[model samples]
Target: MALAFGLAWVLFSIWMSLPWLTDLGNLAHPLIALFVLTFIAYVPGFMNAFLLISLVLRPSSRRETPAQWPSITILIAAYQEEKLIGETLRSIAALEYPGKLEILVLDDGSRDGTAARTRDCQALFSALPNMELKLVREEHNRGKARVLNHGLELASHELIITIDADTRLEKGCITSLVEHLVASPPETVAIAGAVLVANHDESWITRVQQWDYFHGIAAVKRMQGMYYGTLVAQGAFSIYRKQAVIDAGGWPDTVGEDIVLTWSLLRQGLIVRHAEDAIAWTHAPETFTGLAKQRKRWARGMIEALAIHKPLLSMRKMRTMFIWWNLLFVSIDLTFTFAFLPGLVLAFLGIFWLAGPITLLVLPLAALWNLVIYRIQTRMLKRMGVKMEKSLSGFLLYAFIYPLLMQPVSVWGYFAELFGGKKQWN
Candidate 1:
């Protein structure tokens, strides 16, 4: 961490000394130029540089397996997931685990046939002597956090895992999660798994999202895990020590329940790690509206976490830096949406003010960051026997256009949370 910090500062020093940046500062209001340069360029560049250095310097080590795997309860949170619930259940049924497993489908008052379909799949998939499948029905529409708390009460084992109803696990995913969780340091109470896009071929939106998941989200989690605190034990697929979660007050009722829960655990100084080999494939939203809604919910969730866990800002730990890093995302998103984007339009119309040649200096770092992360993630996928999707168009859109759409949407979400927008679970 010290090395990474030094490396980041060194790069920042070089970036600050650029003559064009000085000129830009002179050309505009110094504060405005600093805002654009600091949030828009330096913070992101520093983070990427830190992640790259840490990954290269302290790569993940291979661990030996435990003598015996612990029994675990798997919770599937469902809400109008009739179409995808069966396949998800079957994937859990086919898991390659040695320990006794209990599968609970928490139906959160779905009007659809989710419960019936779970029952049908249960009959076919629960024949294994070591595993049992059951459905817990909530007649009223409670949110995911409440339903998960309900599942926690019925879990028979100390180890617990939460997976989304729309998520499908690879055959060895459970094994991988259990292995890593058991092998982690004693302070580690949770292990987040890798989630890939299953519907990347469905649309351009999904395609771009695939790259986002593969390059951005996964790489960030991997880096965070290296520091012994994976920020979000994402509900899509993650394992937890049951008592640890219970002590953390269970999942919170919020737009970003998972992130809040994770932060709660972190507040207690407990550690969380990420398991890249534990892979779960999920369906990305295929439409522009769907994508926007998802991103907005995510943005709102970050704000919720920041507001809820303000104490994290006072911690001096290496992992807490991620929380501080997230605080800057607000400014970064704001500048990109309101300043740099409009600057681009103006520059195209023959004005060079907010964004110009100086802005382009950040691109090489961004591109290199993407390349390094892609290589690391693809290597992990290959180790798991999954092939990388060959999509040039997806890469192009993700590299250029995806941010343009997402930053504005995230800004809208930030405002929505500030002004009391309605929250949805699905």
Candidate 2:
């Protein structure tokens, strides 16, 4: 993902350098033309090319496992999530890994029946010869980082897989992830799996989110994995080498501990790879407010991780370049947006002569780019065995609108991270 963004910059610069494209008219400042064109031409082209190459280059099948399967401990962390915890547990119990596996569900002092649900799952799944599920309870409500750190101490195996309480794995997710790990080199410490929206049929918000997951998160991970640049081992469904995590000091106490943990591994020169075939379905925020809060928390986490890992900002490595590029590009985009809006006012007032035709060209170009991404992601969804929702047409129509709507939200996230105190998990 980081590498793609860097390449996007290089690719877009090449696109803008074409004399025929930029010779439309003269501007008071050349960078105004360059920055405007970056969003209009460079972004879409980069995204399309990056996604296609990543998917094409991704490993088609899991490598064959060795004769002896390794032992793994699956950790489930719950905080006030009583309703969906059982289903998650059931899914964990139903996983079809050939290796030895045990599940431990830690209750983070839920005020409801989360602990009871955990007990129920423990009793139900423990009888299975292969599935041995255990229940752990914390006396007080602490954050997820504390629970996971404690889990590391209790884990009996050298490998740990963390699944959120609201997540349900596909039958073969664990097996696939472990296979990917076995296939990975010793320096690669973790693998992040693909996460799909389970409630995709709920609404347009969720449907687009489903679309975004496929195009945005999954595709970007594949690109990063190609170069060992996988940045974040997302907590929803990820596998880790237990000792590597222990050496990195377990999960960091941050709003985005998962991302921070990945960065910590990178600081120690450990590589975090990604496996797309390991699938987990999760519930997304269906309401607008819920979605906004979720995006805010996510943005804040990225900001916090970047702040905590400042030493890597200039390490002259691919991963460092990726992080530095992301921060730089976000700042650049924010600047372009501020200028472009007033530039729009100037164009409407007939001050900037070429702005009209350029605007006309850019919108369709952006939509066309999204359509290309949609077709690619559609194929990925089919191969991943995901069911297309009833609102396929709605998703198609909203692809053009999705990018426009996210601008303010992205800006809000940056501002919130800078000024907001004590971020809450919604």
Index of the highest-TM-score prediction: 1
Identify the runs in model 2 with alpha carbons over 4 angstroms from their true place.
1-62, 336-390
Candidate 2 per-residue C-alpha lDDT over 295-410 given as tens digits, one digit per residue, 9 for 90 to 100: 76777788888899898787767667567645655654464456555656688897653344444434443455455556665775677676656467546745665655565566
Clashes of 1: 0
Error of 1 at 12 (Å): 5.2
Assess the local accuracy of residue 3 in candidate 1 as a C-alpha lDDT between 0 and 100.
Answer: 49
lDDT of 1 at 25: 80
RMSD of every prediction: 1.8, 3.9
On a 0 to 100 scale, what is the lDDT of residue 72 in model 2?
Answer: 89
For each candidate, how many residue pairs have backbone atoms clashing (under 3 Å)?
A: 0, 0
